[model samples]
Target: MRHVLAAATLAVSATACVSTATPDTEPKGVVVDPISWGPCTDIVRPDGEPPARQEPGVRCGKLTVPLDYDNPDLGTIDLALIKIAATDQSRRLGSLVFNFGGPGGSGVDTLAQAAKMFDTLRTRYDLVSFDPRGVDRSSGVRCGSNADMDAYVELNTLPPTQKTREAGRAANQRFAELCKRDASRLLPYIGTGNTARDMDRLRAALGDAKLNYLGMSYGTQLGAVYATKYPNKVGRVVLDAPLDPSVTFRQRTLAQTRGFQQAYESFLKDCVKEGCELGDTVKAADANVMRLMYKLVDKPLRVGNRRLTQGLASTGLAAALYSEGAWPFLETALAQADKGRGDALIYLADSYTGRSKDGTYTTQMSSFPAITCVDSAERPDEGELTRTWKEAIKISPLFGSEGAGGICTSWPVAGNNEARKVNAKGSAPILVVGGKGDPATPYQWAPSLTRQLGNATLLTYEGQGHGSYSSGNKCIQSMVNSFLLKGKVPNQDVACAAA
Candidate 1:
């Protein structure tokens, strides 16, 4: 899940120095004081359940970490944490830390809402989540006001023409300028490598012997980097709907385009079965959808006070592709769009971009591109992306280019995490789960991640949507539960039916 080509998204760690590590790889001088935990304050979930922060016994604290790991004495920034303490303390298995996907998403809310799902584990393990640096509650990246983001996201991203791409780049550059004005200090240090270092500090602060981790989507990439960096400190690991650590930014975009195409097929099948007004065949419906997008590109549709542009329409479609349950919403949006109404899709797009009904926003929009641009180094320029425009359309005329026309390459800072494989050698087995029809991280990425990791097991769910675990796939949920609970990995890859 990306939105308006800006969602190429955005943490941390275990460990001692590996013999092969360079000077930069070893976090020798870095020191963090132990966190003093206290009663948790209520934190509104940026993109999840908002009420969990008020739950009893929930604890919140701030861990001070080096602003730049390479320069530990420079200064420190606080990484926020939320904890649900273990109930069966006598039989506890230490803490299970989490990194929810958004590179920009807050982990505090993710773990808080998920406390009930692991009822048994909750008694045996302390559930913990942290807002990685540059995310919510942490050193968040603040660009311009919500009005600025509203304007930026509305910039057209379709057709990939030189003129339109430049316009998009110019608009993105303006947003980047706003970020540099407000958040330039955190920009350079917001890479995933730095985030991994922060995680190690968190692990040490918690007084845990080893890290028990559960990461999803972009979080999986963070977990892999952490495992590789701190091989000896790893415990059981679960990477669900993972990103291929070695793929370049362009490769990731094309893959996701195809992924969304596949997911759209699923949505189309379900919609046609349910007798929607879209069409009778995939070709007819898809063409109509493409025509709608092109129409929006030529002229945005005004629905109430907001104008629904191609980017918003595409983002709305991409957002619903994230979960099968949201597919019906897409159908309704499409049918309404057919009747010259864009309210449903506008609402959906607003949801994806973290916009409120009152037109405000969380930090997800700015931080998404900021953290993403810093993590990977291969964001293409206008020329490179334009060259691939035809092939991108061939892969997905609707979303093939969502990964293209991005303004990351035009940012103020450079990326730190280079394109490479993450081999967490000399570590415990890492479980990699893939949703067969996951549009965001894609299904094929799991196999790539599974192979890249030194010790990894691939768990496949033959299903539609972005993630599998705890999304109603009992086999996946059970398999992951067993792995996290008993340190077990499947003898071979386990495949499950759609949930």
Candidate 2:
């Protein structure tokens, strides 16, 4: 659901009836059922990853939502959910829902892994997260086999030539065919609007009068769509690393290209100050990185039994740019790559792609394409894609041309691009968190979304990362906590100094 840094990163099967309702609209007579919680079982994990920790007081449940809300009788799908109830029940406000981005990110798994981070907030609210429709354990979409995905990620889409463009399209078409073959029934309904509707359903299931949410990265997009559809239901909402709903697919992609370029430059400057081995100056370090990427295009790097292609290298680099703390690792990865070892870079790439040591891939990769293709409406023509790629290369030669039209170019289903202008008039106050150096969702989009949601306030974190609250900056956390906990909306936009 983001700028496709590489075809590999642009990465589910479901059974249900075709959706006949207008996309993202809740039809009359909709019903919400209470979730039946029990011991956490059936939690999906990467092939080699261990099972979810059995945290005390944690419960797991499934919410059954209509596969086609427009035509409820069509069928139903069960959404996987997890919850850590408030420690101080007497002081509890309600359940606080979270969407950890990825459009396809498995909230069930993420919440369980990162629950410790929310301990303070959990004292007054049950921290809840779910694998939204078309995500893991929720009728997640699956495409080709692990081996097929291995080939898919390594497909080179760079240099924006006729040959490379055609190859990219062919690979996308093949991957799309696999998804259609595996998940045709559910593909048409896997957009943000439906997921937002699922969130409303979730809110009702949790017995909340208003929806309280924390959404980061692409999660911010999902939150915005929800506010657009159910403005009055909006409670205390915090959208960190906000995505601008107003931008078209191409515009978002181009902006991300520039964002990543800026983040990379920032990283290089830090590396130089630290006396990094890559170069003595930022410009030289950048050129060396470009040279490595170009070299990998023709000669793959060997990491044990796996080969690292240029596309995977780019994915690894982009993944690192998501957080400033990862810059040191990126520097180390680059240094090792310069020494002809690709293991470290491959590790970063695998982390982003969710590839396990045993070679099985997570459903997130499959669902990413399913969700993004339907959420984004820009179906650019060949010429348009070529032009965008050219512009991207000019913005960041190392990262710009990794993706052209992304998997959407060959998607089997059309996108609805719901609520492009999300004017959540009269909605409850929202806190929009923007990290000045965020590479994935740029800082500029925060003000854009805050302005659109008239009742929202902008909280700027002068930091470098994809998210703000999770950055552990006390100033940011305090402000966000105050808003989520006590409904303390800042009278004016506030900027937190970087720590």
Candidate 3:
């Protein structure tokens, strides 16, 4: 059921502590405060675990934004924010905002965890990020209780039988109903369009004439939409591991399936060469993984008081595939699972889903369906869903259930989904980075997004994983640094060999 909606894309880190309150009257401008910053305390894991580490000089605060931009009288919600100032103030550039993939990912939390990656860029630009509306600590959406969510997330969306299919449909309906009950007020205004508007407001507040941004995965979608709406306001933008918004829902799903299939096969090939315990041949490795997936469907593997179901297992595998660095952990998890120990795979699954040790879930999963369902208007008929599911399995039997009927089909509100033909005609040159082996946001999307932008340069990472710039590739890093730091757009598309 985790993949029943669009692919969750990137794995985010950390959380923020913020609160919201409304004013007696509408403000003259965008609903906002002066953003009084302080030391970090509540940066959290998805499961409510306390943050492991908090970087010094990294300040946390809240930005109050309109609950409804068009109808400003509706009051306001607080967006969680984090900022690390530039090191070289004498030559400091403007703030560089970032959105790291999940439409539901916490920018504040992610910025906190990933700030070290941008130390060189931080020498000039103030690294900033926030939780968009309807994300964790930003009036985040809530569907049901912890127990209810557990049952919902574990539902067999890839039902092999009619009964399981019916059960899954029932769960989807219930989940949607719960969302409507819990977060109806915030649902309509949380789409990417409003977020783009919010970003502009953020820029104005930061005293910047234009926005400099680095967006990855789903964040690229947010960045592209922003450029289309505020082309004149775009400064230096980097869209890494970009998503091709022009693709139809089915096309995206299938393409993602193929991308992951390729990555998974690549992993298997490596496992064989490394003489991993999984197998000695690619076919055998594939069979071993598939065997584990199929076996867990009915015979759940015990992990203490919990069990590793097929849904969670699939999610864990997909999560590991997001980054090549996690391949070793994935291999270990797979080997452990083969011996009837599900702890390792379960740990990976919990990390992906943001499940805490306390059995509470993070707002990421709840907000994921809420935002994606509202953003996507596609409600394929049962026939179409069945066809998509069949086709997706063919693309990758391991992850094919993702192509089945998604939560959006049963959502209470109809999405105002557009064709997403973004052409930021007057925007500054955008640097689009694509990973050749990106599984979530396929490498092809990099070039596709490049074409979609009115002005852009494509940087292809001839490598593996979900994102390029964060892969620690000096070539990718150098090119992206030049683009953002110096505003130099390459005359032609560039490709960097995987490190």
Candidate 4:
């Protein structure tokens, strides 16, 4: 999902035939037959070769969920699931479902690429994931082609002027309209709360006593909502890179604004130590970046068929800031852009906005706002938005405007759930992880969220990255493994050294 610094899928099962006798129900009294699982299909690699780390016994299936949980009989939608069954089934605890950020990220795709990352868990429990409704492989939204999205994401100016603001407003409205036309049925049903409800149904269908879950980035929000809605039913849940759920949309942007700024500073310090060619000093590098951003505003750089604009450049930088691993690549992109070669930065932007090489989008941007906007209570009118626009400018001159809410203002509907602190009182002890250098969900969010919940433990990777456990940090991995497999929470906040 492309965050207009709008911030912000998934599978189930491996090679086992699992079934339940209890029938699935749709609201009121519509009793549907029990869901049946069998052989998985359509597991092909685009490159014509399987990934080196494919899950050994992965199984694929579809679970039918109510399109509208409020009125289950309203309709039904298919949530595609994939499971990597535990190699040591005799020692299996239960299913450990995982969500890899992006309200639009395909869990099946991500888990496939990083199957080895979950190797430790696969030995103890089956790893299950599902494409949330409105995400890829589900009944997803398709608003525009890659060309249309490219133009939208690569807008040149900030929303500082009425004309500029109107331009963003129009694009947002256009996207909402396109979604209405392309995915009207799923639009009203898409939201964090609804997805959480769907999760409960999935839990029942899977025959789990409770849900054992791991959610990253936006997935943290999903897990939080689930815990809030089903506190008593909660199992072991790890929310990595979490959000301060009580905050409003504008607040969310401000958090990211400061977060990206700090993460960039961290990158700069490392850059100078590594003797990268960014600048001689920190001040010079900062000035160079600001100047380059404004330079793109007045005169965009040509990258193949597209011109790299200020927004694209900013988003590219923001994307790279998610992990310190990308700092070197970001330095190279910036150095090349300074020298009038914009291809590298363009690729970064493409990765951020979900534009494929074939000139089509993957429904990320379309579903991102639809789900995010509806999940919130705030629906600022034009006046409040204009004020937010100015505040965004003052916060981070390079990204403030985009960091704030421009896209959600034009949302066709207000979300079903109101923004508030999630107490999750009856839920069991839950683990919340944060990365100090995480730019997407700032490190502070972990503590803030921990304080909000009734029995939440904070785990900090006093290091750089968006997530901790799966990124190969031994301490973080051990803690997460113990929590999931043995239902143990750290006695106190555990801080791990940088990887």
Candidate 5:
């Protein structure tokens, strides 16, 4: 789900924890059983096709888990799972698990989309994606009011001074208070550690020896945690846009600030080389754009009747920072904002916020803060907060000060888990993928995580974007497919360019 930037960053480190008890010893109340097949009402096939008739061997089932792992007797949650039983019955590989990027991303939704892209792998091994605890269609954590979420998004996450910091702190307190009032019971259980345990339960019910996983962004960190806790059960793991599990939330946000700065520079250079309409020189283009951001900060512009303020401008800029494919659109929005036009930029900002034209919001960001607040352990002391904000502004005048600084200050609770060195020892060989120009999860993070995971191989995509597999890069797709299917690792660091 889309939390404010801080929540999204912290969610990367929140995967389920492994039970300390040995595999032979089941916890007293944890139940594991295979669910019967039924018609999947939620399955949405591309182009209105009927659910692909279950290939002769595929199995669809649900795995039930406890709402709280610490107190298994409290209540049970149903996790939906789908398995494409191996066609090579003679040499069946184990279950290949997946989580689509969001700590809020739907694994079931991902499978529905992946059905076409990964038909080959589907036939060879069972591909499974369960709704992690606290997600749509699974036992979910709700915050009763969208007002709480709106307040969070509207908070000045870009606190620059003591006054702004105080404001952000107040906002955080208010949001936390709302959560405690409405969703107190669900708070502790939505973290990543429990999600990883849920995966293990799914594995046990499915009777798999190890988890073969492909995860991206936040999902990559989830896979990493699973490998760390259950190394012996790791098989052909791939972590794309990997998160460095050892960095604190502030550190990660700062790193992301730098990453976006780097990506912006890359975009400027390319636009200049291409003689794009935005500008002729990278320096000129950057100065003009940054000027627009500052101007908006002081006085919002009007597009017909709607007012586009600094917050909306910052949101638009953050959305643009997500992928290089969005550069031209960003340029156009920037140009329009420069001429006192704000509708285009406002619409882009709305899209990033998951706000529709009709003024309704999807639940993507609703549970984001709840999960993030509990996952991270780091809290920025006043001094550290001041210094980080100053540094961010110096590096990225438009995004650093505004987008990086605000969310964590008022986090309702201190995070339970802090980013720390992750040495996934004894884990199976894991593949790490990095995009050269990914704004949110930088390429540098891939190498950092690869070095930390004892058995990881780095694969580089010399392209721009957040993800590689479906990002229109053949080399990336080939490399990942080969690794997932044949269990072969890249010979050395591999590089992929846009095809």
Candidate 6:
């Protein structure tokens, strides 16, 4: 998930190498280091429970990896890793690494949270998760003060006109300047390719012969880069909510705009069917909601003592659009907003900003954008951005083009040398999953990415939301669990209904 604040709306949404010598020599594209293993320290494990107690059958460990792979001597970073050691040790499958969506999301947190659902796979192999570079408890990258982040969220997303485009450009320039001043050293090294390389290093350090992995949202892109660069070293891999490697930054954002629009429409249709509070007719309710958004853009509403601005309202709306599970709350919020009550919208905005009622942000919004600005290429300039925004808005009026292109354009860095299409020809069979109604990474991206990888099978979850695995879909969980556990790939397309 790419959560960068542009005008208050947090829009959520790699590789190569060479050289070979002999059998005992380092592989052609592999970066080898002297094997070093030591007792894991960095983290102070919780006290009440055993420091490293296994969750069901999974064992946990903390691994120290170099903050910068190119300059391992610089410093070391700690990654919290959890593992479900293979049950069938005699016919043991290798470790399967899992990553949740956020570029700044913690895989360890995902593992800890989803351990129970994943126990089935523990019977076959270790299920592992580690925080990627620039994330929680992993030597993360921090930027300007909370005020700066607040200003960032207020940055505009709509650049439909030349004037708006210029505004966005200025915002981008200012943001870039701030990031450069605050985090120059760490900014340049956070792209997907580097993260992929980090994964490889982790795999080697953990003593895995090959990388067995499961990635979702941004994780899909990371896995794609790894497969392309180290195809031969890849074991069973699963990529959910796959991103289209060919699309430009602006194009990708625009696509997400359309996705949110579709998702909102789906929500409206569903609400109408259920005769929800938002409205009696789905179309009527949608129109009212759009009107409310436009109104907020002009004049923000007040929720008790808090002032809810248009930008923040939009951000909340975008965040709510993320999952079907959020639709009900979104509808209620929209209804309240329609009635001139802004508290619901304010609460939603608070959730989007990762802010608590006591006025504290939950590391998510702060860390999310810091990682995003570094991972992808530069945002487009004023003229180009304006043109793109106009086109995108026309494509999806509900999410207005300017709204979609807002965040990244203001990112601090220029494009790094990240490979667009990964060549994963020799990689083991990889499973690619897509949600039919994913407002972030659309389902269409699955087939495209599958085709890009020489050995990939597309798995379709005819459902809604960002990820499919272990999220209540028995079929997807079973398929993914089985694949990670025993290298089993479904012979044909696997489909699951929206729950």
Per-residue lDDT of candidate 5, residues 227-311 (tens digit): 7667777778889887776666556667888877887888889788877556789989987876776687577797655567766
Flag regions of model 5 displaced more than 4 Å. 1-30, 36-62, 80-95, 110-120, 123-127, 155-165, 298-307, 339-343, 403-409, 418-421, 497-499
Model 4, C-alpha of 78: deviation from truth (Å): 0.4
Query: What overall lDDT, based on C-alpha atoms, would model 5 receive against the true structure?
Result: 0.67
Candidate 3 residue lDDT tens string, 1-499: 2221112234341011111111112236434457778887777643345667776668988877788877879998888888899989898989999998776888876777667789989999999999888888888888889988887766554544546566766788898999999988888888887787778778877778889999988889889888877777889999988888766667878888888889899888877888888887898888888888888888989888888988888778888788777787789999999889998888778877767778887688878877777776777777776777778877776676655546688888888654154677667889999999988888777777888786888988998888888777899999999988988886676789987
lDDT of each: 0.76, 0.80, 0.78, 0.73, 0.67, 0.66
**Model 2: lDDT of residue 3:** 17
**Which candidate has the top score in lDDT?**
2
TM-score against native, each model: 0.89, 0.92, 0.92, 0.88, 0.82, 0.82
**How many clashes in each candidate?**
2, 6, 1, 15, 15, 14
lDDT of 2 by residue, 195-242 (tens): 898999999889999999998878887888788778878999999888
Query: Model 1 clash tally?
Result: 2
Model 4, which residues run further than 4 Å from truth? 1-55, 158-163, 418-421
Off by over 4 Å in 6: 1-62, 80-94, 123-125, 155-166, 303-305, 340-343, 356-379, 402-412, 497-499
Residues 139-231, model 1: lDDT tens digits:
888899877888888877777566766787688778889998999888998888888888888888888868899888888988988888888
Candidate 4's residue-wise lDDT over 96-154, tens digit each?
88888787776765665556678888898888888788988888877766666777787
TM-score, candidate number 4: 0.88
Ranked by lDDT, top first: 2, 3, 1, 4, 5, 6
What's model 6's TM-score?
0.82
**Candidate 2 runs further than 4 Å off:** 1-31, 42-48, 157-162
> Which lDDT tens digits does candidate 6 get at residues 1-499?
1111210121135112221211121236655453333333332211112236334454555666566767767776666666656667786666778777666765664565455555677666677777677665666565566667667666544424556556655765676667668767666666677678778877886678888887878788788888777776788888977877666767676778788888878888989998888778987887787788777766678776566666677777877776666677788888888888888777666656655555544345545666665555656666766666677778775576445445666665665535465657766888998888888887777887787776788888888766777345888888887777767888767677765
Error of 3 at 333 (Å): 0.4
